[model samples]
Target: MATLSYAAKDSRTMVRRNLKKALRYPSLTLTVVIMPIMMLLLFNYAFGTALGSGIGPSAAGGGEYIDYLAPGIILMAATSGALTTAISVCVDKTEGIVDRFRTMPISRASFLTGHVVGSVIQTMTSITLVIAVALLVGFRPDATPVEWLAAIGLLALLTLALTWLSAGIGLVAKNVETASNIPMPLTFLPFIGSAIVPPESMPAGLRWFAEYQPFTPIIETLRGLWLGTGIGSSAAIGLAWCVALTVVGYLWARRTFKAGAKR
Candidate 1:
């Protein structure tokens, strides 16, 4: 019960801290909000048609490329924000803020919890902004309210998983600059998957990666939910990826935290 209480309190405190920071720096918050929207607009309007043409008929089949790309953009936004989380945590570490927290009576989990919760909230905001812009640009999910909720739930899970992974990197990184670079590979993953184009049309080797990769399942699951299609293997694969990443990230973060505490 003590552990659970710590987790709850830490989550709340982290949320509060992040909200205060965002409120104090409205322009920074606005920049975060605009980046994804701009990316989506540029991709859909400027390059989507040109890219869609190369992917063949199935790519442009539904005439709803924006809807098709929404999930990917959402994932990308979440991934992008995670780098900020890592950099912020590293900044805190460098400024001796984390060391100060360590000396206080605060629960160990609370320190990490606050950052994770804050990062997740930021990711959610980015996701929502991207979705809103997608709607404006002609993207609509056919799912019911419940399905929409599930889709959001999946997105939240993915955000948390990635955030935890980023946190681990932040804890052990030698400097702020390197910490910021850790999540770039994750950010580019969805692009290589079926997010922008179907995997079927790719070369054999590229198709193999697309078929077996975690991003494909995540994109497919979101796409299936949006289109009201049948629940398929993609959902299972996505869940498996989340669970695996969560476990691995937890262990790595714990180890990194322990090592940093010693230092």
Candidate 2:
């Protein structure tokens, strides 16, 4: 019980520290807020009509594609948030902060929890901002209350998975710059998947990868929730991916951090 209490207090302290750091660097939060909104507007206006022909019409009924595109954009916001976590972790390690913390009696997991929890909170806020903008720009969905809750759940799950993965990447990176770049592939994954254009149009090699990769199933499930499209096994597959990534990332991050402390 005492150990549990210490863990809780440490997690909260780290979470507060991370949040305060973000507040100090207001641009971080601003970027988190603006990037997703900009992406939503850019894609919805510049490419919505063109892409709608390929991705399918909105289930809210019309050829308009913003509805179909909004979910993917929201998820993309989570990706952006994950990048911030990687950068923060990398910065901490590069500055010898992690080594300093190792000398203290605080829980080791506190550092990871603080970044992950704070990042997830910030990412969800960004996602909320994107959703509001998407609605203003004519995105619509026929989801019920339960479906909306489920959608939020899925986003949380995805965010947690990606956050842990980013945390791992951050810990393993040799420098802040390298850590920032490590998660770049995740940011680009949506593009190759069913995010903007359909995978069907890609050449065979890229098409096969996009079709079979993890992002497609996750996107497909999000698309299904928002637009009343077919989910099929995408929901199950997405959940499995989230679980697998979270487990792998958590293990990797803990191991890496412990190993780094030894060095």
Candidate 3:
């Protein structure tokens, strides 16, 4: 009972703290909200039409190009949030906020939990906005209610995994600027994979990379869920990646935090 109470209390406190920070920085919230939508609109209406004709809508999965692209955009939005979370954590560490927290009697997990929860909430809002814009531009998900829920569950898992990875970067980043730079590769990774366009259209070398990369599996799983398509090995791969990354990142972050505490 005490454990349960501690868990509940920690969750509540963390969420409240994060929300207050978000409210204080309205511009950050706006940036997080608008950037994803802009990327969606720019890619879909502008570039998608040109690429759609060549890929042939059917070859690209028989759906509208925007629909095909929506999953990637959602993932991109989540990635952005994760990157922001890492940078925020790094900043807090440098600003002595983390040190202050370390002095408290609260659970160490509470500090990380609050930031991850806050980031997930922020990412979800960004995703909703992107989806709304995608709808306006004729993107639609054909999945049933259950499938939709599962898709959302996968996204949440993906977000949590990435947030943990980012937290590790935050714990070790030499400075705030360097911390933000760490997630750049991940931010650009989806674009290189089959997220925006099918891998078949790319050069053979690029195709190989796109087909084999972690982003492909994630994008594929999301696409299948959104479009009500048959599940493939990609979903399994995505789940594996999420599990592996989360475990490794959690262990590393904990170790780094412990070392930092001694310093």
Candidate 4:
């Protein structure tokens, strides 16, 4: 009981440390917010009409392209912040910060916990900003209060899972550049999913991949919750993906951290 309490305190301290670092150097956080807003504007104003027509009437939630595109772009906001986690972790490792932390009388678990918690907070803030922009640009959803809560919960879960994965990547990366590039696929994977267009519009091979990928179900679930579309089994599948990813990431990061500590 006492140990758990101490661990919690240590983790909070680390979270504060990371959050302060982020405030002192706001570039990464700004990028996380800006990139999604850029994509949202580009797609909504530049190609909205053409793409909206291409997606057909039913797929666009019977409304403008922004309505259909908002959920996916919001998910992009959640993902775009992942790169910062990997880079920060790598930078700490390369700068011998981890070595210094090891000598401190702090909970070892708090190191990664701090990074993940701090990141989730920052990423969620970015998501909120993106959502505000989305609303400003006519991205309206018919979601109820309960649905909004559920959607927020799911986004938080996804952010936590991705942050852990980024931590693992940082642990194993040979350099900061490698760490930064490794999570790039995650940032853009939504484009290949049901983000912009439905899988029905894709060729057979690409459609198969898009349907089975993790992001598609998640986006579908969000769409259903926000736009009154059919969720089917997407909510369950998305939750499963979040749990599976979180488990895998946690195990991988724990193992890698332990190995580094031993060496």
In terms of lDDT, the best-performing candidate is 4
Using TM-score as the measure, the top candidate is: 4
Candidate 2 per-residue lDDT, tens place, 38-143, comes to 8888988887777777656543245377876787788888788878999899999999998888899998889999999999998888889888888898887877
**lDDT tens per residue, model 1, 1-263:** 98888778866886798668767866645665676777788888998887767665344335466766777777777777777678777878888998988897777777677877887887798788888888888887777889889889988988888888988988888799889788778877887888777788799999999889888888788877887544578899898998888788778877788778888
lDDT of model 3, residue 39: 81
Name the 10 consecutive residues with the lowest summed lDDT in model 3: 53-62
Order of the predicted models by lDDT, top scorer first = 4, 2, 3, 1
lDDT of 1: 0.79
Better candidate number, 2 or 4, judged by lDDT: 4
Cα lDDT tens digits, model 3, 1-263, are 99768876987798788878888986766776677778888988789888777667663357878878888888887777777788878988999999998888777778777887887887787777777787888887878898888888888888888888888899889898999899888877888987688898899999999998877888888888888655579899999988888898778777888789899
Give the clashing pairs for model 2.
none
| Candidate scoring better on TM-score of 1 and 3 | 3
Residue 239, candidate 1: alpha-carbon lDDT: 89
Local accuracy of candidate 4 as per-residue lDDT tens digits, 63-97: 78898999999999988989999999999999999
Clashing pairs in 4: none
The C-alpha local distance difference test score for the whole of candidate 3 amounts to 0.81
